[model samples]
Target: MIELQMYINGEWKESSNHEKRPIVNPANGEVIAYAPEGTIKDAREAIDVARKTFDEGIWSDLPAVERASYLFKIAGKIEENQEELTRLETLDNGKTLREAGYDILDAAACFRYYAGLITKPDGQTYHVADPMQAMVVREPIGVCGLIVPWNYPLLMSVWKIAPALAAGNTIVFKPSEITPVTPKKLFEIMDEVGIPKGVANMVFGAGPVVGHEIAASSKVDMVSFTGGTKTGKHIMKMAADTMKKVSLELGGKSPNIIFADSDLETSVDYALFGIYSGAGQVCSAGSRILVEESVYDEFVNQFVERANEIKVGPGNDPDSEMGPLVSQQHLEKVLKYIEIGQQEGAKIAAGGNRIVSNGLETGYFVEPTVFVDVQQDMRIVQEEIFGPVVVIQKFKDEEEAIKLANDTDYGLAGAVFTNDGAKALRVIKKLRAGITWINAYHPTYNEAPWGGYKQSGIGRSLGTFGLEEFQEIKQININLQVEPIGWFANKNE
Candidate 1:
């Protein structure tokens, strides 16, 4: 019975014509909330607010320290309502409450990290002989359009909002329609915590409408996106019409390379969680496991056994290790990928088929799946399945392992496990990936920069690397001596 409206200029405004869409809980396929079927008119209004706020308001003109204080306020509000936010995220997105708890913590860390960078000078210079000329100056881009993916809505929101706001740009966020509830909560939080009107706005609808408008908007100076590769390409084309600055963290078919010199039992356990966490919906999920031939059988055997033990239930349940997919469509997509794996000659180790477990037959749930003896060229190996499906391949040696890991178009993330630090280092330098973990998986830190080196993404998303993305540089040549350039004036000076 809850009705959601677009948040524009700090007002909860109804859709222009009251057209609405039903947002269903993927867990039970029941309509949980009614979201606005937002349109071009809504996006335009949001952009107009952003433009006015950016050009005239204190939010866009204030010093970075002041802007960061506002962000800190938002972060504090998020903490105060952490339990409620976690429930909303789990109900809307079908991640376990445990996962939502982790996401809130991550969001808090991202906000704190960006808050600290607010006063960082963009670029510094060791001055040369130009005595009359000063150095570089930092400038903020105007308004930004941030499109967050469904898998990690709140976390991605923090990633986009923190840096852009820290750089003094207004934002219009378009969270995925499937996971719109948390953003609505964020809107409420922003207003409650005294964020200036028009500094932050949000809309809800399918991507073609609201998403297209943001990408093609004249006032939107940049588009930051995280989603699938194919859709990202379309977004790129749409944003290219205006040649807007674009940042994308696209899909990944990242590899987990487990060598014989490593701790097989522990490595395989981490690899299982790496691929199957969040139902393998992470952009950096280790979907492709490349095990050294020396211990391939032993490693995958234990991996499958441990994966079979994971418990799937309602995300709100305190002990559920996994939950349903975001929707039935995504479930079918993952199932089809599992079918393709079987057809492409990959062996199904265990749980390749869906299981309607006790008291949860109505939800869109897929069992934890593991594939064995997968080839490098298989569709299941190359393409991002984006579910709790693992495609395990066996490699002969270190060179072959690195070769298999880097074979895909994706270079988002990969891991190498080895007790031999020397060998791990040697292989690490050869793997083509943005984030490479040694002897572990999914070791992301708020302080370390994260992005893909290849088709996986376009920009970094954390620490100092993330802060600089929203800023543009303007070099200033100051005339220390105000002497007119007369005939006697030194030309060099």
Candidate 2:
């Protein structure tokens, strides 16, 4: 097995305590690699170096365009090593190689997109009446702490890192301990691109030790995290002590509404794509399917037929449609939920068991599952399974659909499928989510704002909004003409 070291202060080294953890490939339960088990001290070292790098202005004080150049170089390196990176990501995360390829390309595009954006110099100038002028300038918030989740590991890391770096901030990033291979490879490319020493660093460890240290540290200026809602809330409370800036992209149980007027084939295909594409591991998975009562039976039939056709196996296999869960613990969690769904009276229309056949006995594989006759309040529908499972329900009308879709704590993402233009707009407006789709699902872009409402998350993470998350705005007001008028006379008078 390959052993990986933590990247800190322009050096690849072991943790302060010299501890290590194994990285398992979920596909076959193989210990493919090992990473440093970083401690609070290691996290502190990363934060301190990042703090010093920002204070020294080695990177943050450079011209915006100059910073963009470094990002461009990083993007180029991703494309050049796409094949190797893709393999590593799939081996680490157990996502299909094709899906990993898409993530790698998207990651590269994100850096390139930020490269172009930083060139614009996101600042504004205004001319007030007469002799007064005002300028609004955006400057980097120093020593940012970025914590990303295990799913889509590299893509999510770049989503946070690209914008933060483009805005001229130094970073101390912590990828999830479950999947650290690709992020390590990414730092290799960052090193090759000659990123200034201490400008960017990576730590490997659990959230309680390394993660909380970064969030609570006084030296860190901001914390951007993408993970579970409970964890996000804990980070928020921790950061409250220092009053550090925070941006979170948290969990979701997004709704996918299908009206009777929608195209059945297209809607069915999109519904499957939204939930099972990543084995339903996505935070924004449309796990709740609310179909119009008139066509509920027909849609469920089609959805189940398609769900059974999905081939689950190792991610390295080019023909496998879905791969294993990230770990055995997660597999058990999903199986328990399936048992709970049965007890709650939700019918298992498709699959409800683990896949241990077809030479896949060792891997943590789960068959694509679909639950029907599911009520809105059922645990399977209300909670995020984060597995290859989905629940289907029937809605009577537009008002009921909207009400059902909004009847959850999460308001991250939702989808509406209907041919009626006016109805699509009207329903989309009523759905309580940051990202809504019409006749489609799970297609996010680089130029649009991506985030959620309510308990879903606190702030946006992509496009111009993402860059602003790592920045602080300053308003500069000046009087062109020298003025002597004052409310109070001089102290001498």
Candidate 3:
């Protein structure tokens, strides 16, 4: 099995405690690799290194063009190793190779986007009423702690890393312990690109240990995390001790509102793609689908028909349309949610059991599931199952559709599928979400701002806003004329 080491302070080192955790391939329950299990001390050492690096200005003092050059080279290296990275991602995270390939491409694009963006003029000069000049300048926020989720390991890491590095912030990264393979490869690429020592470091371990240190340490100037809402809240509390900046991209139970006027076949296809992609482990998965009363029955029937056709198999299999869940523990969680859906009196309209046949029994596989007659208050509809399960609810009119979509505490993402452009626009305007799509489901762009309105997240990621998250804005004022007015009466006067 492949053995991985933690990248800390420019050194590839094992955990100080010499502990290792088996990295399992969820596809077949095989140990694919072993990763260093970092301890609190390892985490502290990385943080200290990052703090010193930021203080010394080894990277933060570099010119923007020089920083952009590093980002460009990192992007190039990622492109050069695309194929191997894709395979490693699939093996580590149990996603289809095609999906992993898309993530790899996007990660490269993210780095390139930030590289170009950083070279552009960012600060603003303002005209003042007095004879003084005023301007705002952006500077790095010292050391940053970046924590990413397991579902989109490399892509999520890039989402935080690209912008943070572009803004010239030193960082201590912590990837989910369950999926450390691709992240290790990413660190290798960064090292090969010759990033300055301590400018970027990574620790591998459980969240309560490594992640906690990153969040709680005073040396960390900011923490950006993408994970469950509950965990995001805990990070916020921990970061509060140091009064550090925090950006979160958290959980979602987003709605996909389908009106009768929508293209039926296309809507059905996107609906399936919306929930079943990544086996519904996506943070912004359309788990709650709201359909107009006129077409509720038709949409439900067509959606179930398509969900049943999705080929559930291993990520490496060429014919597999949908891969297994990320891990056996996650599989059990998904299964339990399915049972909860039934217990809450929602009708199971499609596959809901674990798939165990055709040599797939060893894998953590679950058939794509659908639920009907689901009420808004039911646990199945309100909570994020984070699996290949979706609930369909009927709406009487446009007003009801808006009400149903806004009912959730999560405001991460939502979509409206309809033929009438005006109606689609009108409904989307009312959605209490950060990311909204008209006639589309899951097409995210690096140029667009991403996050939520409410509990879905705090602040945003991607686009220009993403870079600002790692920066501190400062105002500078200068007197054009040297002479100062004697406002205060002097003793001689």
Candidate 4:
């Protein structure tokens, strides 16, 4: 267990109120850290620091290449401390060390990728009404409010921060109350690297208090939020009061379509790992596994077997493949969903009971659950559980598969597994999702754009798309180069 201090105004300080929340390890239900509990007052101070830093034009005025260099430094430092970060994440949030460890690497990669992108330093240059006088520029959108979730805390933090920083926007970030240690460590690392004061400030508080403050803040130019869809809607409404630009990566009810002709082995492997991995807490979890009717039973049998085979325990244990949920509330929520599945007449193929009752002392651990014969409109199939639970439904043809796959308010991510190129491409084209995997799942990269079409999200988060979200484009008019192409605004042409 670690005691973490708040990082604000380029230094570590105790909150004015000096309140602290005990972050418990879900794997063992033990206190892992005493994290600061910040108030709305602290959130305002953090925003002030960010706004002042942006107005000062220290980082924003810097050359893109130089900004990129700083990103590299951060990445290098993260790589150097990967082991410590992995352990911290596992202890703080109840994820396996291996998954959290790789997340650190991915976080470093995101920063490095965004860093390289900012060096381009150009926006628009093309034929205009006045071709010779045409101009283009980019301006930073001042202070950003980054509200991150407990799952994948560090990686998600970097996802919000790196690109915003690369685009020259200072940030007042709020980490979820459950997992506050990683962000503190990240802030400490940034301070060690000499990132300017107010460039990055953090407040530790929950959704209603701290999260709402960031969303409703007039000082913040933009809000980048990742969380449940309902909360995201609340955030959108809150930010709307001030007309702040917002990028929301919300919940998903994504599908995984496995054709009968596909390579069943590889497809099932990624299919199982996709939803079951991370204890099925991923936003992109292929929760709805839509298989061809021919191989549906076989696939379910294998999937259920594989799912039941997983060994669950404390995240610190190297042998533990799955750990506990983040808290008791979440555990109960997942179990309630299991009850919903049974009530909806969906068949539970394997384990559906709680698993932590044995040797586990205090963590929130539940058995991996798989459901079959699920109706398309069942509540369990419709809502996101955010746990190690998956719903399996069958489709007779490609049309049915595509139909079932597209039947959701959330269009975040989906997958189509088939060896036939035509079938795969057909399904890929038909599946209306943000990121559709041809034969894989959860394979997002820093270079590829990641966003949703409908309720899944607002703007892209990674690749060039993520970096540009914080940049406001401006057209520069310079008559020094040439004359106007057409007399639209000026008679001088």
Listed per model in order, the count of residue pairs whose N, CA or C atoms clash below 3 Å is 0, 0, 0, 4
Q: For candidate 2, what's the RMSD?
A: 1.1
TM-score to native of every candidate shown: 0.96, 0.99, 0.99, 0.96
Q: Give the CA lDDT, 0 to 100, for residue 299 in model 2.
A: 99
Write the residue-wise lDDT of candidate 3 on 260-359 in tens digits: 9999898888888899999899999999999999999999988988898899999988788999999999999999999998999999999999999999
Q: Which segments of candidate 1 are over 4 A away from where they belong? A: 121-123, 486-493
Model 3: lowest-lDDT 10 consecutive positions:
484-493
How does candidate 2 fare on TM-score? 0.99
Q: Any runs in candidate 4 off by more than 4 Å, and if so which?
A: 129-131, 481-493
User: Hey, what RMSD does candidate 4 come out at?
Assistant: 2.5
Model 4 CA lDDT for position 140: 83
Report the Cα lDDT for candidate 3: 0.94
True lDDT of residue 130, candidate 3: 90
Q: Candidate 2 on 102-174: residue-level lDDT in tens? A: 9999999999999999888568889788687899999999999999999989999999999999998999999
Query: What lDDT does candidate 3 reach at residue 209?
Result: 93
Please list the C-alpha lDDT of all candidates, in the order they appear.
Answer: 0.87, 0.94, 0.94, 0.87
| Model 3 misplaced stretches (Cα beyond 4 Å) | none
User: What residue pairs are clashing in model 3?
Assistant: none
Q: In candidate 2, what residue range of length 10 has the lowest lDDT sum? A: 121-130
Cα RMSDs, all models: 2.3, 1.1, 0.8, 2.5
Q: Encode model 1's per-residue lDDT on 1-493: one tens digit a residue.
A: 5667889998998788688888888788889998888889999999999999999966867877888787788888899999999999999999999999999988887887888778765666545564566678677788999999999989988898889888888899999988888888888887897888999999888899889999998889999888988888888999998989898889898988898988887898889889878988899999988888889889878998898899988898888999888998998899999989889898898788765768677788888998887777899989998999988888988888888889999999988899998999898888788888988899688888888977898988887778777878887777677866576867696
